[model samples]
Structure formats: structure tokens, C-alpha cells
Target: MKPLSSTLAPGNGGAAGQTGLETNNAGRDMKIIATGLLVLMAIVYFTSKSYEEVHPALGFVRAFAEAAMVGGLADWFAVTALFRHPMGIPIPHTAIIPRNKDRIGNTLANFLKSNFLITRIVAQRMHGVDLAGGVGRFLKSPSGGEGRLKMGASRLIGDIIASLDQDRLGSMFKGAVKSQARDLDLATPLGQILEVVMKENRHGPLIDSTIKWAYRTLDANEYVIRAIVFDRANTVMRWTGLDDRLANEVVDGLYKLLADMASDPEHPVRTKSEEALAQLAVELKTDPALRERIEQWKLEMIENPAIADWIDGIWENGRNALLKASRDPDAAMAGHFGDALMQLGSSLQKDPILNRQLNRFARRAVAGVVASYGDNIVKLVSETIHGWDAQTITDRVENAVGRDLQYIRVNGTLVGGLVGVSLHTLGYWI
Candidate 1:
């Protein structure tokens, strides 16, 4: 009895005992049919030997036919056993696909990563071509780029305006204030600002008006002054028994004295206030306790609901300002920003050196980011490659060209047989 594999060999000229599957594949089908026909032919020749003694030439034909059947069946079995169990008997080491589908997928992934997605291939693709340039081109191009830029600007402004929630605004303000408190020495900035205010004479007019109001307040309250003076005169009259008219005269004089003191800008009280403020500044600067207290007081204020309310108001104001700017592009806020932007653009346009520096910085900044993340790209490929299924790799390749490869086997059989016969005839003639 022949082993089942020999007859199933798809292209080889083997024996007649090949399995039925060779007929299923297009290339192997004809070989299988021919194998069967050859077996029949051999059987016929031998059977004819009974009728008439057959020549040895017929025996050679019988040998060739038998061999072809064996080759066809063996090849057929070998191919079929790869994808399924032989005859569906579920034999061990057969039907590898269904048993290990995940492994197949993994192997396929690995093969792709190794062969198609290697680092050199990736690096070669990455070299010399300005990815940054492409993005810049896309953004800065004249063809609809200006429109896109405007749209992007509008969207950005809109999103910023919309995303300005109270919590976010509060957080931002809190951050700004906290940084100023911690990082900025308020005394210096405040002093400088106050100096500027003083230098500009902005505070002088206000202070002068306040002093003039104090003088007016005294004039308005002259009766209170007169009452004090009259009351003192009454006491003096009781002491000296002076004339009533003379006492009244003394009281009137005292009234005038009180009014003068109140009216004077160089009054002792006003001078003392200025001195006290100066002393307070010294304490704020030199006194650690005072500084600590200031910080504590600031922290308390920041935590206060008033601060939160102020943040809300600020956010609302900012939002309203932005909304106004967005709605009316020619509004004051928008106009100011536009003017500032135009100035900046004009400066960049004028300053060649500065423009080149900016361009270089922008390019380097992008390159830096890519260099930082490049390793991750490499790792992704390697890790993927290291985890795929071998069989899956094989199967995918086969599917891509499996039908084509079947022709190779068919052509090989025909071509090999033709060469064999030609050589055999050449030798016979020689």
C-alpha cells in the first residue's frame, strides 16, 4: 500500500493513489485528472496484454502514468494539510490557522514591522524633507492660506472668549496675583509707580483739591468752631469777671484762629499724615513681621469671596471686551490690538536680522520636538515587530499571490515534462 502523500504531490508525476483534493485547486486539478487518466491508460495497456502481447514501449507509458499519479496526490496532501486537518480528522500538527489565529496575526505584524517599517526606512523618509516647511507652507501659502489664517484667528479668538469660564478666569487671576506677591517685591514697583505719579503731578492736583475741601469743610462748620470759642470765653468770664462784650470779642478772635488752622494746607495735621505714610513705607520694607503680615493679609484677601467676585467681574469685563472686539472689529480694543499687531508685523518686516533669528528659532524649536519624540516612533515599530505571528505573515503573503503561484506549479510540470521528453529524444537520436 502506498503512503497517502506520494500520490497527492501536485506537480510531480507520481502514482494513481493521490487524494481527491488535487482536483480542487485549478493548477493541480488537471494534473490530478491526467494522473487518473494515466492510471487508466496503464491499466488498459496491461489489460490489452491479455488480448495481444504488448510491446515494451507500452510498459514505459505505464511507469510514467503511475509516477504522475503519485506526485499529484502527494503535493495535494502537503498543501491541504497546512490550512486544515487531513480529511477533517483533526490530526496533530495540522490545520495550524484555526488553532492559532492570534499567533498568526502577531507574526504577521512582526513581519511587517521588520521588513516594511524599520528604523532605517523611517529615518530615510524623515531626512532632508522639511516636514516643518510643509506645515508652514500649508499655513502660510497665498492660495486660501490667508483665508485659513483669518478663520483660524477668528476661531481662536472665539474659543478663547468662550472658554473664559469664571473658574478659569479666577485661576488665572489667582496665578497672576500669587506670582506677583511671591516673586515681585511690591514695595519697589509701588514706590516707582508712586514716584512716577508724583513726577507727573497727577497726585498733586488731587491732593491740593482734597486740602481745599478740608478748608471748605471748616468754613461750613464755622459754628462748631465758634461754639468752642464762646464756651471758653464763658469760662474766662467767670474767672475774671470781665465785661460781657469784651468776652464776646475774645471768643470771636478764637473762632478766627480755629478757622485759620483748618484752612492751612501746611497745617500740622496734614504734615503729620504725610510723615506717617512715609514711616509706614519704611515698616513695610524693613520689618519682616510686617512683610509676613502683608503676605498673610494678601492670602486672606485672595481666599475671600470679594476676590472671587472681582474675578467674576474681571472675567465678565474681559469677555465683554473680547466679544465687543469680535463683534465689531473696529472697536477700541480690537483697534488697539490690531495696531499693536501691525506694528509688530512692520517691525518684523523691517528688521531682517530679527526676522531671521525668529525663523531660525521656530525651525529649531520644531526640530527639537521631533528629536525628543523620535525614539518613541522607533520603539513603536520595534515592539510591534517583536510581537507578531509567523504563520499569519506566511498566510498574508500567500493570499496576495497564492493564485499566481499555483500557475508556477502547473507550468513547472508541463515545462519539465517537455524538457524531459526532448532530452530523451535527443539522446535516442544521438
Candidate 2:
């Protein structure tokens, strides 16, 4: 049975087959016409010779007919010899295409490799191609490359999502996160962050808030302060009535001092708080003992089983969410992927620098490949031609150019007749 493509093709004979058939038919038709003219000339020559005694004009007719037959026969031989020996007689230089098919093939291959497939020619042609512009137009078109890309990406994502082992991914993710955390030294970065905060005076607000909380606590617990003051008084003074009054006076004085400290921004206590923070920041950064302690604490946390469990839990939760989303057709992940592809296409179109780089790379890649494989291509062409039989080569060449060659036979017969007539007239006039 014939292939579907062959069956569905426009004509039973394809382009090359159709062209070969047409040429063969035309060549046969011209051969018949040329042969018929030759036969007609022969008949006329014989008839003129037979009638030459009856009329003097018959001599010129005989000359023209004889010359025309000679010309037609000569042209027919010349044309036939191109494909085969004329009349089956063995002749040199006959059937030239079949005789030198291998050499012809080699020459043709070399010519193509040198002229058409050279690195410079390939590069120049590649550079001239508007690859970026074509891509841009395809992506920009609604039903063109953009839609195809989206469909392809969707299928790929679906396949990948379906193929993933959730358990394996979860384990890998957990292991990777824990490994990274354990490998990282947290102390240096933390200290640097603290140093930056202190330098920018960001810790000032924190100190103020701490001070306000302390003041609130102290004010609310005045009775406790009073009892402590009374206990600290002399035993004899406590026994007298003046002890209570003296304790009140001391408590009031302490309250006044607290108020003054809190109200004044430049108070000694505020200055001391700022100084303490600065000192702490410096120690965290510069003090090796502090830094080592912080590192040790971080390592302890990382090494804890609880911390490992926590990391695993995070991975499990994330995996579950991802798997669920992947199963959903309307998931944002697929949409986001599509958007990203479109954006990339747009960038390739709009960004001249990127487009130029892409085109330059493409040209270089094509040129490099052509340079590397050109010899192989030439060899392939030569080998293909060499593989064909002599008969096949003869048929192919004759079919391709035979129709045009038939015209020479027709011209020769007519021209020879005219020349013969002119010569006969000149001879008679002389």
C-alpha cells in the first residue's frame, strides 16, 4: 500500500517525476517530428532526382532535400550520442554523464563546499537572518509560537509534577536546609547587624522604652519601697513617732529624683544607658570571647533534635502545599511560568543589546559548525552520486535537458534546406 503522504499529494507523479515525464514525452514528440522531416526530405530528394530530366528546377529541389536530410541526420546523431552511442555503435565521448558521473559528483560537491558552505559565507547568511525579529513576531502572535510554547510548557510541568516523589523531595529539602544552617556561622553576621544598628542610633528608642517600663513598675510598687525604707531605719528611730515621717520624706525624695531622670534627655542615667549599648555593640563585634559564646549557642540550637524535627516539619508542609497546587490546573505556578516565558520573549524583542548578543552567538555557532562539518557534507554528496548506476545517471541527465536538445534537430533540418537552396541559386547564377 502507498503511504498516506504519497496518496494525498497533488499529483500521482511528484514534482521531479512529473518534470521527467514531461521532458521524456516532449523529447519523443520532437524526435518524431525531426524524423518525419528527414523522411519527407528523402522522399522529395528521390522524387526530384526522378523528375530532373523533365524540369531543370528539379536539380535545386534535389540539392535542398539532400542537404536537409544530411543536416537532420547529423543533429539526431549528435543529440543521441550525448546519452548513448548513436545506433548502438560504440563511440568515444558518448554517454558523457554516465561515463564521468563520479568525477562530476566530486566536482559538484567541492564547488558547493567552497562557494556555498564556507564559514564566512555561512556566518554572513546567518547574521543576515532576522532570528530575533521572527521570534518576537511568533511570540507576539496569539495563535503562533506563544500558544504552542504555553501548551508545551504546561505538558512538561504536568509531567514533572506527576513524576516527583513527594517523600524523597521532602527528605532532600529538609536535609539541605539543616546542612546549610549547620555550615553557616551566625555570630559574625549578627554582630555586624548589631554594629550597624548601634552606629545609626537605632537602639536609643529601645533604651527609652526600657526606662519607661522601669519607671512604671517602680511607681506602682511604692508601698513595697516604703516598707523596705522603714526596715532600713535605726531601731530607736522606728520606735519613736518620727520614723514614719522620716520614711515618707526619703520616699518623696527618691520619687523626685526618678522624675528628674526620666524627664531629662541628657540626664546621667540616659547617657549611661547609651554608653552601655555602645559598649555592648563593640564587645559583640570585637570581643572574641563574646563571639565564641554566641557561636557555641547557635551550634547548640542547630544540633538539637527538636530543631531538626522543626526543619522536617517545614519541608513536609511545603511539599504538601506544592503537590496540591501542582494537581490543580488553575494553579498560579503554571500561569507564572507562562508569564515568565512571554516576558523572556518580549525581552528578546525589545532589548537591542540582548538581541544583538543572541544574533552574534547564533552566527558564530552556525559558522563554527559549518567549518567543522563542511568536509563531511561534501563527502556525502560525492558518495551519493557515486552510488548511482551509470544507466540511472544517464536517464536523470537526459530527462532533465532532453526536451531543449530536440529543438536543435528541428533548426538544423530547416536551416540546412535554406542553405542548400541558396547555394544552388548562386551556382546557377554563376
Candidate 3:
């Protein structure tokens, strides 16, 4: 930004033209007016000859009028000199504002610092503003609120997600879980976050939804299920070559048993299976050898084809969600995320203690950023100044505000004449 002084500079070509025109007009007008005034004063002095010869009052009037003429002439000359040579005489200290335009700019800068740059005044003006409240108010609006949330969250999440190294993540997880034997003791911080998910019942839905979906879509394909039934029944049929009725009876019994197992969770057979699993879970938790076996089983299970297929499905679901989220802003699932962010912002704003903490963090962050970038600001100034030619600076200023300055010359001439008349009158009065 250009300084105020630079902004007030005279205009170029057109401004120069206008200035020239005004200077000429003022000069012509001043000369005509001064000469006319001089003639009038002379007439006054000569016409009162009787008073001048005998009367002190007439003499005094004559002196006064003569002095007034001299004052007016001197003032007119002085004022005219500001724009051009007075009486066509080239003298120093004339037309100062024009001849010393660059100097005037430098002095104007000094004047600004001396007159306006006081820290107390600046601080007072700034303190009068409730900047924090205004910012809060702005961020409270729906659109504005969303915009602010997106800006910060997107910056953070983008950086994090983009820089994610799966290997590093896996290693970090492994390292984190490495201290425990078989099972890790959950940290309080982790537990607290987990508690919220539990309290909110968010985790229940995920497990319930998955199980429900799997059950609802159970593969009841006749060939696949019947194949298992017939394959087992065939062993008996092949061994005995049983009658058709016996074969049919055996297959029916086999299906009934499978159905019974599937339907009855608390059946004796199911109880035994459940107990064995529970016992294993306990053994894995308490026994080192059992824990290693369990870990091996877990790793093997993860490497299974079915697990890969499940994982592939999960990856597809996640990718699809992200794709839809990024493309379709109106997608409820994605929009909910934006809404959640807005809610977070609102919560932060309402929570005074949290707000103060955030503000402190923000201030420190801002101060660090400012400190780091402080040189850039100075560098920018230095580079800008270095890049700019002096003539360009002068021209830019002149273009912006040069025309109005010609009025100064006009004011000078008129004001000078008034001062001259006053001084001349005072001279006579004495």
C-alpha cells in the first residue's frame, strides 16, 4: 500500500496541463487586480492633496492608502511566486510546493510519523473495537461458520490423510501394542474416547448393522447347502447302498440336525461350542502359549481368502463413500460431516473455557507464524521498493492525485492578497 503522502501527489500530463492553465489564470488575474488596486490607492492619495498638505488626518489616510498599495503589491508578488517567477524574476524559495515535490513527499512522511503514528493513539483506536466478539459473531453465521470449519479442518485432514503411510501406521500400531503380553491395557485417554463411543451407542450400530446385514442376506442357495447335506449322506449311502426310503430318511435327519444347530443358540451342542470359545478367550488372555497360538490364529485368519474378500468389500465401501462425498455435496452422509463440524464450532464458541484455551493456542500459533514470516513482510517491502523505479513511483502518485493540488496555488494567491491588505492597513494604523 502506498503511504498517504504518496497518494496526495500531483497528476501527470493532464494534471500538469491543468496546473499550467490555473497558474496562468491566477497570474493574469493577480496582475490585473493588483494594478487596478494600485491605481485606486494612488488616486486616493493624490485626490486628498489638501488633507495631505495641511491635515494630519489626510496625511494619515494617504500613508495608509500608500502602505496598503505596497502591501497588496508585495503580497501579490509573493503569492504569484509560488507557481512561477514573481514579476518574471527567477528567485530561490519561489514555487516551493511544485519545485520541491519530491522533497515535499519526504517531509510529508516525517510529518505523518510526528503527527499520526503515536502508539497510544493507535492502541486506543484498536482497543475501541471488540475484534474477538466480531470474529465470533461472523463465525456463528451458518454459511460463514461452515466456511471457517471447512478451511481449518480441510487443511488439517488433507495434510494428515495425504501424508499417511500405511506402513508407518501399521508400525505405529504394532509398537503401541507391543508392550503388553497378548493383551494391552488401555490407557485412560483411549478409554475415555472409547467410553463416548459406547455412551453414544455408535459402536453398537456398526456391529449390529454388519451382523444384521449378513443374516438378512444369508446364502441359502440349494445347490451349495444341499451339496453339503448330500455329500455327507452319500458316505452312508455308498457304504450301505441303503434303500431309497432309508437314504431319504438319512438326508432328512442330516438337514434337521443342521437346522437345529443353526436355530438353537442355547442347545447343548451350541452351549459346548460357546463354552469352548469362551474358555479359549480366557486362556488366550491368561496363558502366554495360548496367547501366541491365538495371535497365530488371528494372523492366519486375516490372511484367509474370505477375510481378503471382506476387506476388499470394506475398502470398496469406503472408497465409494469418499467418492460420493466429494462429488455430491448434498449426500446426507457427507453433509452430516459438515454439520458435525459446524456443531463443533458452535460448541467451542459457547464453551468459555474451551474458547479461551483455543484462543490462547490460536494466539501462540499465530505469533509463531507471524514471527516466522516477519522477514517476508520486510523482504516484500524491500523487494517491492527495489523492483520499482523512482520515476514509476512518482508517476503513479502523480496519476492518482495530482490534479487537486493546483488548488493550493490558487489558495495561496488569494490568501496572500488578504494577508497583504491586512498588514498594509496595520502599517497605516501605526
Best by TM-score: 2
In terms of lDDT, model 3 sits at 0.52
Weakest lDDT window of 10 consecutive positions for candidate 3? 181-190
lDDT string for model 2 (1-430, tens) is 3443443333355454676577788878877888888899999999999999999889999989988988888888888887788878888877777778999999999999989999988887897887876666654453553654555444445556546677788778877887888778676677677778878978767776876777787779878877886878888888885678876887787667667767787888778878887777778778899888987888888879998889888877766665555344334334666566567678888999988888888888888878899899999999989999999878777767776777888788888988888899899799
Give me candidate 1's TM-score against the actual structure.
0.38
Q: What tens-digit string does per-residue lDDT give for candidate 3 at 123-219?
A: 4444444444444554445444465454444334434433456557544544443334234322333345545564564554444454445444443
TM-score of 2: 0.46
Candidates in order, TM-scores: namely 0.38, 0.46, 0.34
**What would the per-residue lDDT of candidate 1 be over residues 9-117, giving only the tens digit for each residue?**
3433422223223433544455455445545644654654454444655433434434444444444455556566778787787766556655655665566556645
Q: Estimate the lDDT of model 2.
A: 0.77
- Candidate numbers sorted by lDDT from highest down: 2, 1, 3
Task: Decide which is better by lDDT, 1 or 3.
Answer: 1
Ranked by lDDT, the better of candidates 1 and 2 is 2
Taking the candidates one at a time, how many backbone clashes does each contain? 30, 0, 4
